[model samples]
Target: MRQTGAVDPTLPPGWPAAVRPPGAPDWEHTAVAWLFDLVPPDYRAHEVLRRYPVLLARFARDHVAAGLEAARAGWRTVRVELADDLPADAMEAAITAYEREGARLASAARGVEAVAGALRGERWVPRL
Candidate 1:
């Protein structure tokens, strides 16, 4: 077996710790998955990356944008629907939940947008 050198400094902070399951198709591909998962729990981005693969680079920006808008609306709706009788702490917690999810969704959409931009020769790197 070949001795490995240190991890690439340019990659994400914990990229060196990325786990590659046994029987992976390729190291580079698995690394990309690890990179995508870095976005965390925003499985939609990973799903798009996996499903469309090359297509995501060419398409799906609009879909991602729409999804981001929807997430924002959902978060706003939660706040607007809050009851006057609800405890302040409870309302804050509920809104925080929406904010967190909305942020994650927005990030996921941006990840997809980055791929689209990369396709157009933007500085962003395409995950695939």
Candidate 2:
């Protein structure tokens, strides 16, 4: 059976397959679900479930922004540490990774927005 999200289908039995857009990487797609699970059960039951879309959008946007900031900081650190000795290939690889991860994070944020819009009765629905 296919499983969904960061809940680790392999780690737990009966975890539902994470619903996500086609071609989304497993890591990025699963991150949202992992975040959802991080909320306290009581809050999820009472507050999150009722306003999941809005909450999710906020959560995703914050997460992506934080990640981008961290990545930028890390890149700066790498540059400072290596200075003129920096390996061109390694720097290129780091840049590529940062770009890819950024795109993934932006996509996830968009997904959250779409969910929020749907919850607001906006007719948008993510393709399963």
Candidate 3:
């Protein structure tokens, strides 16, 4: 069993540094803030999200997953879709941008999943 106060080195990549380990005090508040960042600014206007964080985490997860998928699709077709409008160099840059955004969205997706699990009272345990 892990100590309550120990830093969790086993947290998966993309876990927000701002959120304390599960079972720590006020971790959910920090998680809500981080989760809000992943979603659209308009989401902040919803009082329900503030009142119910687990629901917010679900929304964030869906939003980030969709973004990742869109980035992948964009990267795959940007060249052919925009070839007539963009110069060769510009097309290369667009592809690079899509690649970078896809990576970022992928990381956000992982982070949101971890946060959602934590919000649902799940704890990570280390195995020998």
Q: Tell me the tens digit of each residue's lDDT in model 1 across 53-93.
A: 44443344455556568767866776567666668798888
Global CA lDDT computed for model 1: 0.50
Compute the lDDT of residue 1 as modeled in candidate 1: 16
Residue pairs in clash, model 3: none
Q: Estimate every model's Cα lDDT from 0 to 1.
A: 0.50, 0.52, 0.84
Each candidate's number of clashing pairs is: 0, 6, 0
- CA RMSD (A), model 1: 8.5
Task: Residues 5-109, candidate 3: write the lDDT tens digits.
Answer: 455667754577767666678878888988999899999999999999999999998999999999999999888889899999999899899999998898788
**TM-score for all models, in order of appearance:** 0.45, 0.49, 0.87
> Model 1: how far is 46 from its true place, Å?
14
Candidate 2, residue 58: CA error in Å?
1.9
Candidate 2 segments whose C-alpha is farther than 4 A from its true place? 1-53, 69-81, 125-128
Q: Candidate 2 on 4-103: residue-level lDDT in tens?
A: 3444322222222444432345533453454465344454455564445456546655766687677767656766676677688987787778777766
Which candidate comes out best when scored by TM-score? 3
